[model samples]
Target: MTGTASARRSASPFSRAGVLGIVLVGFAAFIALLYFISAGDTGDRGNTGAAHASATGLNGYAGLVRLLENEQFDVTLSRTPSGLETTDLLILTPPLYSDPEDIAQILEARDYLGPTMVILPKWSASGPPNNLPAETADKFKDGWVALGSANTLQWTSELPAPFALTQKIETLEDDEVPQWSGLDQSGEVPTKTIAYAEQSALHDPLITDQSGHILALSVLGEEDSEYYNNAHWTVFVVEPDLVNNYGLSRQENAAAAIALVQQAGYEGDYSAVTFDLTLNGFGGAENLLTLAFRPPFLAATLCLILAMLSIAWRAFLRFGPAAIGGPEIAFGKKQLVSNGAGLIVRARRFGLLAAPYADLSARRLASRLGLIKHDAEAIDAALAVRLPEEEPYSLRADRLREARSSTEILRAAQALRELEGKLAK
Candidate 1:
């Protein structure tokens, strides 16, 4: 008995409090871990693309930004038209200008600005069709050429020897009195020929106009100049292989394209490449950071902080014991049934149930007999008429009397129940 009492005392209010604390703290720690995993590192800092593009810094355009800096020019590579105004001689590359909408916008800007040199690199074909209006196409046709032989050079064979590129050329045409021998098809119109390939095993003569003006010359001997008015406003080079980055990366090809551009009389201030974020109303440096801190993240942070504070407050504030008689206690199933049985036995032993049971049986019997009146006199009369047999009626009457005695009450109740079943049938 003493050990049992000790065990009961050991499970006290303070011990229960400690267990609750462990559970609450463990849950809070789990929640905290989830929050950190989802949020990652929030305070990481680096140069924003806008800041880098605007500062003439090297962080904006990936690796190529370094190359532009090394060449002593500022490049702001932008997606917006207004950004294009910040520099002269825009050098467009793939991807950024690959979309038709962006390309059309850039081309539209050409008429307003000075002459621009478009370098058709090898992968330039991925861009959408210019679909430029016929008028615009004619105006810019001579200026723009796909980098291949049949398009720019008049004949396939007239192209220079010792050089082989990957394109098919059908025929070569002649200058007035120039040789067209052994060549069947006519050459590309002269209006489109800016420069043709001249170096070949066959005599790929360099052809020019009657004014000693060289139309297509060897890529190896391309020249540079300060004025474009010396020729027309536009110059077409049949194969820009001499100008694209793939070729320009090599010393020989790079120098050649630069010289040709210069010889075409393109002189302008080369500085900053701008990146346009105006389409998103996120032009300045703060826009990117603003997007990073939008509403959902803000709400989640607030909820986390509130939960932590609630936990800490509950930990420190005292939790008084639950009040006495706070809620009614519930008995076990067996205990409740036993209590009901005891009440019934006590009522029968004192004969307290005789009057109530007799009254109940009479009313029930009257109801079963379909009699409107259900007094004792009425029930007895109805039973006499319906049963007509005296024995069963007498037995019922005797059982009702016996219900007052403690020992015989159950027998009396059973007889009344049996009579009720018979009447129901």
Candidate 2:
């Protein structure tokens, strides 16, 4: 017994406090990792598309976004539908293949919310092909596209009631300088062809070219609540080159672009101008992984992290004395006999148990009373000296030996066991 106590305990490689420190630090680091990953990017590819606010292509309007930002205006690239309903200015640059109903639905919802500007797509743009020459590929810039051809949107001609529009492309020669006048500013478009909307009786013209073709149109809602809640102005830019990156290259066009955004949808000094990207397919949807690190849920996530740290602490520092592992098999005659009895029981030999149990009980009682002879009568005489009121051991032994049925054998064995236990006591 002293051997276990006398041995010196080997020092643990890490103490309990050190282990707790490691667990807390590791948990904090894991939480930091999740937070950073969730907050880094909403999976929006930078300046990759041809016409979205995030793109830098000639047909894209990212330059306009930068220009507005430089002018101290709050500009946002909206990836969700909720951003489209801002009570300020919302700019939409939907692709050519976009659904007209979807566009109409967005406008219908935002009728009372804010002023919206729809700059229709004009150029069919694409990236450099795989068969591009090395010199040409080297010249190609990232997020820059090749302007293939000029076109018009089908929805422009099928706008909501009393707002029908149609467009005709006009090719400009190198010598021809077709100037546009709008927003009290004049600018010459930088593209080879200018797509201008034809005359429409339903809408008022904001900007017109030298040919009097409408470059921009503003549909005003009647003050009557049946037609509209208020006098809302929905500006439509037919030729995107008037405000696209190619158009913004000219200082005059840049000024005109900013004028169109501010004068048309001016809300307040700090009212935001939201540029939509969902129609161009850069939408950020709700997700469990993202929500866990965001507001409201972040508090619960932190609580869970704390609970984990507490669990680790409880496991590392134990209470009371350390319990040494016990032997796999207990060291006792009872266990040895139990193994033997289990084997005997498995053999289905009930008759063999009664005689052995009686003999064993007699020997145990005889040894306990210091009797030399282990016979049933001798054990009975010795046990009677210890306790005179007990049943005779010889009588119990005869009954157990003569037992034939399984029930009689079990009953006799139980009686012998009880008698031995009383003598032992």
Candidate 3:
């Protein structure tokens, strides 16, 4: 008996609390998995293009990223535009084929974002060919060219007019090295020349080449700028080659890049430097889920979550104990009759039961009238005498005995019921 009771208990479903706990655990596990998959650090901290900071290509800025990390600066590669909405220094290295209007939108949206540096694209490069041996392929050179011609400034023309490229590539003389403070010039500078441009009156010169064209310009913010105000500082670097992979190969160029980062006010702080990948053809795609959790639809997401929680709470509160059924063989005549009728109907034997039921009804009626020894015919004749002349009880009894289908049985049974009512009267 104890073993049977224990088995029944073990086979039962979980209680409300137990089910709730299981659901909560499953939800937590799902959230943890999502976080690990989406945001875990795999250490590729640069743009997605072939020659950006994350790439190992000759024109990439991976060396610059390493150099900054070596200097104890926290540098993160941001794959989404939301990562740009911070107080850190944001560096954007847009590709040559990128839309200028899109770049303009990103810049315009950075009203409250901290110091931003836009590095003008300088190299036209392609990836190495596929047919070479692994060692030779790994050492393949990226076919890069300096964008010094006027026609190559089409993309730059779409930028804010003050930061536009000027079709001039100024070559620095050996005696005309930059005099910027904090720049380490002990080692060789990779390229003596870089793309040059003129800045507006609002901009201040940070670095210049031999021909006096500005290579770097900065626009500082006001002293008491409000949050999200349009007064944040913006820096424009005319030549990216000065800090890219080939350039950073020279220790002097790497040092110069570090100095420029410090000049942008990220000298000592970790998590203060962020590189942008959205413009380099990475991660900016938005879907329904992403849109729902963003600004305009965030309230909708909250409402949906609340509705789900409310339903769950209601379900938990309304949960009741399991219901136990009665035995298959129930007591009482009404139940027995119902069960017998159900069995006859299920077996399609209603017509066969019609004659037997009529005889039993007649015998019961005769006994109720104190004529216990009378047979079915005598009971039917007595019923006919009591019933109306238009509907004879004997005729109903005969029809019930001769019924050959469920439909005929139903009609005869209904007539017999009417005859019984008349006989009772």
Candidate number with greatest lDDT: 2
Single out the weakest 10-residue window by summed lDDT for candidate 1: 178-187
lDDT of each: 0.42, 0.78, 0.65
Ranking, lDDT, top scorer first: 2, 3, 1
**Prediction 2 TM-score vs. true:** 0.71
Q: What local lDDT score does residue 405 receive in model 2, on the 0 to 100 scale?
A: 83
Candidate 1 TM-score, true structure as reference: 0.28
Error (Å) of candidate 2 at residue 184 is: 1.6
Question: What is candidate 2's local distance difference test score?
Answer: 0.78
Candidate 3 at residue 124, lDDT? 63
lDDT of 1 by residue, 129-217 (tens): 36967776666422223323223222223222212222222233344422111111112222222333333322122333333333333
lDDT tens per residue, model 2, 1-425: 44553332223456667777887799777766665444343444544446978778888888999999998888998776668778878899989877778888888887777788899888887887769999998988888888787876677666675445787888878888888997799988786588888776656787888888898888754445443446456788888888889899999999888887876675243357899887887665544467877998999999987997688768876622354556767778999988877887889788888877887887788888898989877777777788799788888889999999889988888888888787666
TM-score of each: 0.28, 0.71, 0.55
The TM-score leader among the candidates is: 2
